[model samples]
Target: MRLVFGLVLIAGVALAGGAVYMARDYIAQYQDQLARERQATKDALANVKSVPTVGVIVTNRAMKYGEPLVKDDVRIVNWPEDAIPEGSFVDMAILFPEDANGERFVLRAVEKDEALMKVKVTKPGQAAGLVSQIEKGMRAFAISVDVSSGVSGFLRPGDSVDVYWTGSVSREFEGGGGEITRLIQTNIELIAVDQIAGSDVTGATIARTVTVAATPEQIAALAQAQNTGQLSLALVGVQDDTVATAVEVDQRKLLNLKESAPAPAPVAEKVCTVNTRRGGEIVKTQIPCTN
Candidate 1:
């Protein structure tokens, strides 16, 4: 029994030693493979060159029009130095001179990571108001609006609209004066609803007045038309840039009334006068006139 136990112990020891040797060899192979992978990765990285970049300021969050800008609303990212955009700001002081605080506003909606440009933001310390939204060389003009005329108060800032003038065409024309509604402007962009300049798209409240961006000529024309007649707005879609044809409606046209023939022209009248003279005194007699 002792001899058999000794032989069994020897066999168990040899099996244990063999298992340990195999384990060590497996670990060594794994280490060698890992080292080779590490060197290969390093070589690949060395061959790949990275372009140098410069820091640029951009909006940290998506911003809406007329919203005040703050330090938290912006961030800096490494931009390709060769691809820097014009008017991009690289330093905080340049974008917010004198520590403008929250006085600066975005004139238009800016997405996250969009480059902060001087043209996209209002002047330092200036609020994004109706004037900022107004394009250069353009003026703002407000006209009274109501439920029927203002698309049931669905009109919002930044919406395009068509303006119409409704009143009598001529007060002293034949057959009395005719009422007419004519389109005065087309594709006019509304800058504000009441006093708010930002886009208030919610139709929760009705706006009493809507302001529109207009040129000097348009302003003058609208000013005169507003006084001469009742001006109304027809809301147009933002994507709709279709040019509207001249649209005019009168009572005759609305009811499909036949146009009356023009009145006959009047003839000029002729008159003759005879003069009788005695010495230096003279007497004149008038004759009847005929057409």
Candidate 2:
């Protein structure tokens, strides 16, 4: 009976050793897998950090038109260098100078996290007005427009339009003058309409006058056209890039009238006279000359 108990104990010891060996094998495989996953995670993070980035100044909160912008209104964020926006303020010093006497103002509405661009804000000590919006070497010309000529107030700042002139041309001009409508200018940009200059203007505004940014020569042409005839505005599509050719229409052209040729002048009849010397005064007789 003692030998039988000893053999049973030996069998139990063998089973326990086998279980420990299997557990060690399983643990070794699990540890290797965990180490591999950890290395993969580290490699991914390193690859992400390899890409270059740039620091760009962006607005921290929403900004409205003509709103003052202080240093606290913006913050620098790390942006992808390749995806950086044009005219973005990468340096805070350039955007807000230390010696500036006044703060800048927002020219247009900007949402949070939006890049602070030069076009979206006014310069230091500058006000957000028509003067700031005008381009260099360009003059702001005001055009009088009514409900029909103004596109029913669909116009907004920064919109492009074609100007038309409609009035009578005097008989002093060539081509037998009459009332005509002609396209004077195309693709002219409006900087302001009446007092509103913001491009984010909502709804239709029946403006009495609109200011346009034009070169000196263009301003002169527009001035003459406005004076000689009534000026009308036609809104141009945002995506339209085609230039309009010279267009003019008169009453004849509108009705597709065909002009007739002028008639020939009347020819004078030639007469032959025969003279008689029988008397003191010479007598002459008329006869038809042969052609």
The models' CA-based lDDT, in order, is: 0.85, 0.93
lDDT of 2 by residue, 177-240 (tens): 7899999999999999999888888899899999999999999999999888899999999999
Clash pairs for candidate 2 = none
Error of 2 at 151 (Å): 1.2
Candidate 1, position 289, lDDT: 58
- State candidate 2's TM-score: 0.77
- Best model per TM-score: 2
Candidate 2 lDDT score relative to the true structure: 0.93
Winning candidate number (lDDT): 2
Listed in order, each prediction's TM-score against the native is 0.61, 0.77
